[model samples]
Target: MTRTVTLCEVGPRDGLQMARGRMATGTKLRWIGQLAAAGLKEIEVGSFVSPRAIPQMADTGEVVRGALAIKGLTVCALACNLKGAIAAHEAGAHVLAIPISVSDTHSHANVNKGTDAQVEMVRSIVDWVRAQPRPMRIDAATATAFGCSMEGDVPLDRVVQVAAALAATGVDRIALADTVGYAHPALVRDTVRAVQDAIGDRLHKLHLHDTLGLGLANALAGLEQGIREFDSCLAGLGGCPFAPGASGNIVTEDLAFMLESMGHRTGIDLPALLAARALLRESLPDEPMRSGVAAAGIPRTFHPAALAA
Candidate 1:
């Protein structure tokens, strides 16, 4: 039996936020609908960050509300602070992901806060979530867990410590992210194992980048170590604000194809996913789109699906 994996699409949020041009709200909605139609169950709709900082997500609340209307789909949003979390929850986000950088320099530059400050932000967000009438799942994603572009090398011990601390905050899940595309497969395997050992099932997902073309390799390493949930962006539409050309979250279509081809069930349609990518290209003509399987095409001998059909 093929192993089942959950591919969390982060295109609407992470992918578009770093895009060169801000997509029209209706266009974003269309792309998201296309993805969901292709059988993606979960997607990060938008971020509740400051409009000045990330203008692409200026309509976060609108996007969240729109996504909520999609049946059987889980909508997630990025919340950097307690206020953002409140906005996301009110907008009807099912999951709220708060990023806490592991590298002190990156943390200071990205969130304008150090490790301790990030921890406090996570704590505040958790507390706020607890008080909300409709609770949203909180995921503490330790960004730059593998390495930092500004800081150069992040200590693994620090990553472990941050994960443990976030885990202590009563977060529903903890995630490790390679924000700058600095993680190799070996590092991914080892770090995921270590974090899982520390937090057990609390370690929920792995978010990676394709800056050096190691995205799929690192994802396979993660799968080997028992991580089922992954974060990916459509057509690789994201990049770290600090690291130029470092592609945003993993490519969703490619990742889905890789997993399904390897006898893993993603419950996603590759042809439909490719068609969605085409829609995205039409919507964002100037944006640089990416995907391994989309470019290479599915092999002639491969079966479309093998599990739960």
Candidate 2:
């Protein structure tokens, strides 16, 4: 069977969080609306981290509420701890992703917790989420599952162990992330297979970054491994504000165009996705934007707009 894929737009959260300038809430909502109109079914709207840590997400509650109004969109948000998880729940996030770095050093530096502590946090968050009156999905993303910037070449056993530990938390789903873009294609395939072996059907999404320009390559490898869900940003909008020279997450428009042209259905209209990139450019003029399809322009043979016109 040819597996279908789901593109979960992370531009609103991951893209904007690490950006230089903050995007207005209305503009964020507008961009989100454009993404929905482009046929995206799921979007990571914002993070519940401290406003002091990531001021760009100060208005996460507002964004979540606005996103909730959009029918059929599974609005997700990142939460690092139990506190952030509760905030996500209160903000009405349909799905809450808790990131736990695999490397002990990275985990400590990023979440101020050791590996075990982070696992405990996930446990608490899972329990808290299940107690909510309204149903909400929890996805635990093993950040730096392949490699880490602070700690290079994280061992495969470590990543597998973390996934195993997170599974004990009873999360609705689990995802592996190359948070620093340190992952190569082979490593992506191998690690994804490892995690999937440990968690089976619970392994649902892959979050990749373009730091080394292999975002698409890694994504393809994961797809070949039967990963149906992917996380991407519009116009490649974000990078680690603290980690200079790192590019943003994988470009959603480019990824969608690639998949659809290859006879894979993403349910997204390529032309509409490109138009949404224009809105992002207009909003953040100074921010550097990047995308294969947006820059190269669609070929004449792939006239998506002509059919719609």
Q: Given candidate 2, what's the lDDT at residue 77?
A: 91
Candidate 2, 1-309: lDDT as tens digits? 233679999999889887777889999999899999999999999999889989999999999999999999999998888888888899888899888888888888777789889998899888877887888899999988878777789999888999999999999899998888888899999999888888898999899999988999999999889888999998887766434456689999888876766656788888788899877777777888998788888877663322332
Ten contiguous residues minimizing lDDT sum, candidate 2: 300-309
Against the correct fold, how does model 2 do in TM-score? 0.95
Error of 1 at 131 (Å): 1.4
Residue 127 alpha-carbon offset, candidate 2, angstroms: 1.0
List per-prediction Cα lDDT, in the order shown: 0.87, 0.86
105-174 per-residue lDDT for model 1 (tens digits): 8888887889878897788888888987887899889999999888888888888999999999899999
Number of clashes found in candidate 2? 0
lDDT of 2: 0.86
